[model samples]
Each structure stands twice: as structure tokens, then as C-alpha cells.
Target: MSTVKDVTFDLLRRLGLTTIVGNPGSTEEPFLKDFPKDFDYVMALQEASVVSLADGLSQGLRKPVIVNLHTGAGTGNAMCAILTAYLNKTPLIITAGQQTRDMLLIEPMLTNIDATSLPRPWVKWAYEPARAQDIPAAFMRAYATAVQQPAGPVYLSLPLDDWDQPMDATDVLRTVSTRVGPDPARVTEFGARINAAMAPVLVYGADMARGGADVWADGIALAERLGVPVWASPFCERPPFPETHPQFAGPLPPAIAPLSALLKGHDLIVVIGAPVFRYYPYVPGSYLPEGAELLQVTDDPDAASKAAIGDSLVSDAGLFLKALLPQVNARVAFAGGPLRKPPQTPTGELPLTPAAVYATLNALLPDDFVLTQESPSNIPQLQDQIRVRKPDVSYAFASGALGWTTPAAVGLALAERQSGRNRPVLCVMGDGSFQYSIQGVYTGVQQKAHLIYVVLQNEEYGILKEFAELENTPNVPGLDLPGLDIVSLGKAYGANTSKAETTEELAGAFKGALDHHGTSVIVVPITRALRGLLG
Candidate 1:
């Protein structure tokens, strides 16, 4: 006489989705009722925060995490956050409570009128179970869809009244292969293409970073043996290679013209684990330099199909690296300016510069600390100043969505505790982006997630203003954001707060926050300067 909830709980327990993450509503109570004592529930005040938090947790754990949302309203709230999860290639099983089956004829209040379609184009699969007895099977399908290659979030809507009406729950678990072995012929062909190119470059993307230490070693081996320069993919959510390495060229500009120009001299561009290009602000030009050819290796078939210019091989990044490594011939040495010239260090006068802020952070931060960045205006500055050398230690919203980082930081801190890694987390956010998921501060405090938030208040949407200048659009209003008191906001949520306007103050505040085992916000007012839209 096992109920649907009972069978589902057992399945969830077996799946290691024992810790449920989300913001639930009345419709969800039936599924969550008398929540199992062995399971834990992580709640967020906003639906968007919940989704992103789950994303971070999943990425940190390197596993599929389950999240619960309230039917239509919650799903809508989390749509953009869900998109970030999708682009990040993080595995997530998203479940929503639906209106009772009996009430569907009348379309009752809180009913997900179009539940199945609401999260479309972002989620891989979205379904509302046909019957109460089918809930457990639907969950199984959702999990399988989510964790498969090109891992991403999948959705399932369960009617509120369906939790108790279930019968069979005997044998439902199945093992599935999450990685695809590289085709030996394709691998040989890809290696041949690499070996044929005279002047080649490697562009590492987020998925390569997702492979952690083992894959990073293989990537380094491949690059050194090929005697080629390495560039991180533009606008990558996670940088694939160590920034401070000798062969590292700086990040490729995330615009069409500039990206093409940067790769102008290179005859072949080999992109691994990232899109061929991810651009913003519509920079039109050739997809590649005049004589250059492009090859993309990625797990996501969608990325390969959508690439504007590239020969693609769909394979697991780690396996592809290992398979291709031995076939390529070693070169004497890369014969060009192997690394791109870095921008000159900024000298500060009175108001703070973006580079100065990042430089101070870089100088003072410990090597082991994790950085979650969402400061859009200062992305290039931070990437240049900060060296991301470790795998799964740096994260940004792949979808270019704000509000995901702060909550993500909290979730990552929680994951660190669970894994006993317990590396301190540092979240760098723009003041404008901070307010988008400000409620994350409360969640951090409640969950005892020790994270330090460094919010740079530039008194404007600086990146947008840069975009305005580039796009030559006149009189775009709402570009300036003024009168935000992040210190007060942080304090209201029971977090330790500080304001650091000077370098000395910044160092002290950062150290103090780092030493404390709780949530802290260090707000800094920075002068606005545009580094161009592509940066």
C-alpha cells in the first residue's frame, strides 16, 4: 500500500536527490508533506534564486540535483535562471507542483495552464504526468534526460492530488551512460586536421573546465605537444585552462569582428568544450579570419549544430583529449608571440578603477579560495587580474543572466561543506546585479553558508552604457542606477556588512570576512570606465 510519495521518496533517495532545493507554494505541499526525516530541504525566498542555487550545487557536486517549484508562477520566476543552468550544461531535475487532475477542466487558480510549454526552449524535456500513478516514472525520465550527455535541466509537473494515489514501486532504477566514447575514425581525422595546420591555436571552453583536474592535465599536455597558444573561449562560464600558464593567450573577445581579428594570423582554430563563439552587442564580421579554418569539439550536439563556422566532433571532452593526444605530432616550439600582451595595470587616483579593484582582490585573495563573479562591466579586468588555474573553482552565469552568482556562491559554499573541501568562497557582483537576487543573503545566513560578497557599486549600468556607445543608440534611459545602499540591505538580512572605498579598507574587510564563518557583504564604490562591449 505504498503511496506515490512513498515510492517517489524511495526513488529520490536512491538517486541521491535527498536534498531538495527550491521555494515551494501551497500546491507543492502534497508532494512535500511530512517530508522524510532523512532528507533536507533548502529554501530560497525567490524562485529565480532557487534555480540558480540548485545549479551551483549541482555543478559543485558534479551530479544531478533536484529542485521543486510552484507550477506556473514559480516556473516563470525561474525561467531566466533555468536558461543559465541550460547553457552551463549543469544537470538538474526540476519538478513543479500542478493543479489537481479534477480541477483541470475548470482551470483553477494557480493551475499551470500550459505547464508543459512554459519552460520550453530552455529545458530539454517538460512534461505533466498523465496519471497519479505515473509520477514516479516521470521523475525517472526527467533524471535520465537531465544527466545524459550535454547535461541540462529537465522539468516535470506533478498534480497536487497525485502524491497519495500510487501502487507499484518495485523495480524502477536503471544505470545509464553519461559519457559518449569518441569515434576512433573521427578522432584520427580531427588529429590529422590539427597536425596539418601550420599555425594553430586552442580555445578552451567551460565543458573542459567541468572535467576537473584530470582533463586539465590532458589539455595542457595537448597544447604543449602541439606547440600552440591557448585562448579561453569568449564569454565562457568557466575558463578551461589556467590563466597564468606560459602558453595562455588572454580570453578571446566575445564579438564577431574582434574575435576574428584576434585569430587573424592563426591558420587553424581548435575549440574544445565551448561554443565556436558567444557574442553580445551584434558585432558583425566574418566568423573566422580570411585563411583560417575552425574545428569545434563539444559534448553538446546543439552547440555543434548551431556554430556558425566550424567542423564539429561530438564527444566527451576528456575522452577526445586522451584519444587525440597521441596521434598529433610534437612541434619544436610555438613560433609567435605565444601570449597576448596584457593591458597595463591601472594606476588609481581618487575614485576606484575596475582594474584597481580586481588587482587589490587578486593581490589579497588566497590561492585556494573559490570565486563566483557577476560583475559584467569589469569582466576583462577580473579575468586579466585573477588567475583561474583550478577546475570547478570559478563560475559565472553562462547565459549572461545576472542574480545567479550570489545565490550560486551560497550553494557552492554549501557544497564545499558537504564535500569537506570547505574552501572559502568569494563572490564578486555588480551593485545592479546584487539587487536581482539580494534575497540570497538571507538564504546564506540561514543555511550557514560562509561566503563573502564583494559588490562594486558603479552608480550606473556601466556595461550597458558601453553597449550604447558601441551600438550608437541615442538616449537609452534607465542605464543609470543610483541611490542603492547595499550595506543596509545586507544588514537587514542579518549578514555582516562593510564598506571599503580605499585599498587598505578593502584588504582589511576582505580578510575579516574571510576569517568569519558566515555571510558577509563588502560594498565598494567604483568609478565607471568602459572597456568596450566585447571585453
Candidate 2:
């Protein structure tokens, strides 16, 4: 019989999981020894960065990636990234090493007590095989569960001794189907609502992006054909519709009242791929306008069940949109309310406002550049000034995790490079978020990937300040962060760095960095202003 590690490699190869992202330790060393020459192991400085890097690669490559982690401590460190992956529905095959089976009951130093439950709720499935022979079966099940509809991370705990034991051939050869189609009846009823409504609106989210460009084009066709205004889902990190399209309404606000206000006039609302709505600040409002009806199409049953005001159909977003398109009538002119446009703001001197910074970048944006953002306080202004004309060109942290986008951008850049795409990756993150995974810059520098990092150094927790203003609370504690040199930090990480305080300076720095090869960082010091949900 072949050894467990050999069979595990075969199974991974069969599943096309050839890349591994991890921050390894003593417990994981046995499994990683003499790692196969064909496999790529991407290492990260921290466990959080490891999982997040895999998250981006998985989403970018449109497949699952394997993640190896240490015992309990490493798993604990990676929990936040796993949560982010869960929220984004990214497929991650997360495996953790455990103490030897012989020593598990005796409570060896690094044993993961109750290993099976350690990554629960965040993963689709969690397991620690009862016997060494069952390890291959556990991984097969994990792969299937992770790639299935409503895909998310899956975890497995393998003891150090397990990798040396004999494996079962049959378990490694098992295969499973992953894709699921929408119910025909529910799809027809959904089409009927679209056909009958005088004024209908479409709200879509990241799930649509996961369906590929064909699905994105189909969604645009369906919306245009139905003459419905399209709104990106509230708090969505993905671009479901082209932002530059004339029919495109802006993003739905995270606040309940404004969101309700925005949809008040639409007679029928169809929300696809997103949760009903994700809100911030406790604002009370009706779930829907008095006479309006809501229908949601999603792949996750949990999202459907937890939604506040819609009847939901569980289905793949792309399949549902494609099925519904043919049932609608001829395209009608948009007769609903006027679409919202970003307000024009003056670009004052020296210390530029957030809007001005966006304006400068927007004017200089390259045709082949991709943006990964994490500057929460500046996002509203950023979205207004900069527009994504296509799907898969922009990414952000849907889970609101601070460190995700910076490292994720690196992974995306690597994937884009490996795929022979020449797009330059741009990462815009707040200074506060920058520190969370700053070591990722070292990876980008070492890999010589094409990337530009823009740090919005505002010297305070601006989003929290805005929240304070919204809640009418004064003298909030721990809101100010003064005098941190992000440019120096970038330079220390081997990135060519510059700081800009004026619009002219910003434009110069941006132009210079974009023209330079490899990775560069441009830090902009801006005035801290609390606009309170209004951007």
C-alpha cells in the first residue's frame, strides 16, 4: 500500500489543487517534507496573510486552493481570514496538522484538543479522520463540499503520524459533481414578476462576478432588455455591473433608511447574489416600501433564510439570470427615477481632500490596471470619482477585515502574471489597514510583481469618527492616530516610496510610480474630515 502522503498528493493532483499557501510550523513539517517538485508552496509571514492570500488566488483563478496551517495557535490566527473567505463564498481547502495520534490522548504539547470543531461554522465541513486510512476520504469529501453550491472553506485535521500510514486507494479515486442549476418553476415565476412589473430594479453582488464574463454580459443584457435600473448591492466589494454604464444606479447605501428611500418608487425589486441588505449603524426602517414586492435569487440557503423581506430561490446566479432573460418582453426605455451621479467637488490646494485624490487617480487610471481597495472611510468618494467599466477589474474586502485587500492584491497580481495577463495591480488602503499585513509588501518585492500601493494617511480612525458623529456621541476615545510615517515603512519593505500632500504632488507621484516597473508605494497625507455616512 502507498503511504498516506503519496496518496494525498495523488488526490490533490486529481482535483487540480497544485498550489499550497501556508505559514508552516513543527506539526506541519512532516507533511511538507520533500514537497513534490510540481507543486508550488507560497509562504506568508503570518497565518492571517496566508489564508487571505489563498482567498484572493482562489477567487481570481475561479477554483479552490489548498491552505496548510500549523496546530491550534496557527488556526486561531487564521480564523479572521477564514471568516472573510466564508463571507465571500471563496473555496479554500484548509488543512491543519495535529500532534501524533499516539500522543493525542496524553495531551502532548501542541495537540489540538477537539481539533474537528476548531474551524467550525466558518467551514462547510470539518473533520479529523477516525483512522489513518480515512485521511484520503476526508480530503476528498472536503474538496467536494468546498466547491459545491454555496461554496466556502473546509477544514481537515491530520495527525503527524497519519501521513506515514498506509492509504486506501478507493477513497482517493472518488469524484463528485459541483455545479447546480436553478429550479425551472421558480425561475419561471421570477420571470413572470419581471414581465409584469411596470418598474423593476435589479440589485446584484459578487456571486454574479464569480460566474465569469459571459454571465456578466448576460446579466447586463437581461437588465437592459427589461429596462430596469441596476444597483450594486449595499456594502458589496464586487462589481456586478459596469459602473460607467448609463443605466447603472450607484451602490446601495449600507444604512437601512437611505436604502429604503432609494428603492421606494420601484414596484418590483429583484435582488440576486447578495443578501437582502447589509446595514451599518442601528437605523430602523421598513424592510420594503408599502406596495413593493421583493424576490431574491441566491445559492446559499442561509442567506435566503436570513433575509428580511424577500421570497428567495436557491440557485446559481449566472444560471438564474440566463434562464430569466428569454422570458421578458422587448426592451423598454428606462422610465423610472433619474439615476444618481457623483457630485463635482473643487480640488483645493496643498492638503487635498479625499475626493481630490480620487479625482487625480481617476484622471490618470490606466486601461489595463486592476484596483483592490480597503480604505473604508474614503471608499464612497473613491467609488464616485473612479468607475469600473468591466467585471473582474476591481476587488475589496466584503467581510470588512482590515488586512485583506493589500495581501490579496499581491496574490491577484501573481495570478494575473501567471495567466499571461499584463494588467498592473493597484492597491488603495488606509494607513490603519496598511499595518495589519505590511509584510506582504516584502513578498511583492521579492516576486518583482507589477503593483502600486496607495496609502491614504489621514492620521485618525476616520470611519469611527464618522460613526461617532452619526450616533451624536462626542469625545470618542482611541479615535486619533497621529504621526505614523507610512512612506518610510514602505521603503523599509524595499518598495520605491513617495509621499504627497498636494494635488500636483499626488499626480506626480502616481505618474512616476505607474511608469516604474516592479512594486511602488505612494502615500498621500490628507485632512481628516468626518462626513458621517454622506461620504
- Find the candidate with the highest TM-score and give its number: 1
lDDT of 2 by residue, 1-535 (tens): 7888888888899888899998889999999999999999888888888888888888878889999999888999999999999988889999999999888889889888898788877888889989988887788888889989899999998898888887556545666666678899989998888888877889988888877798889888887788778999988878998887778898988877778888999988999888988887777788788799999988889989999888899998988877888887866676755476655674695567888888888889888778888888888888888888888888887787788877788788887876788688889888888888888888778777788998998888888888888889999888888878888889998998999888888899888887886889999988787667644
The collision pairs in model 2 are: none
When summed lDDT is taken over every stretch of 10 residues in candidate 1, the lowest stretch is 335-344
**Each candidate's TM vs. the true structure?**
0.97, 0.96
Please write out the lDDT profile of model 1 over residues 1-535, one tens digit for every residue: 8988888899999998888898979999998888899998999999999999999899888998889999899999999999999988888999998988998989999999888899999999999988787888888888888888899999998899999885876657777888877889999998998889988999999888888889999999998898888998888888798887779987888888889999889999999999988887677899899999988999988888999998999998999999999899999776665475564587876478877888888888876888898888888888877878778779887888888998899889989988899888999999999989999999999998889999999988888888888889969999889899889999999998999998888889988998888999999998876777765
TM-score of 1: 0.97
* Deviating ranges (above 4 Å) for candidate 1: 334-344
- Assess the local accuracy of residue 453 in candidate 1 as a C-alpha lDDT between 0 and 100: 95
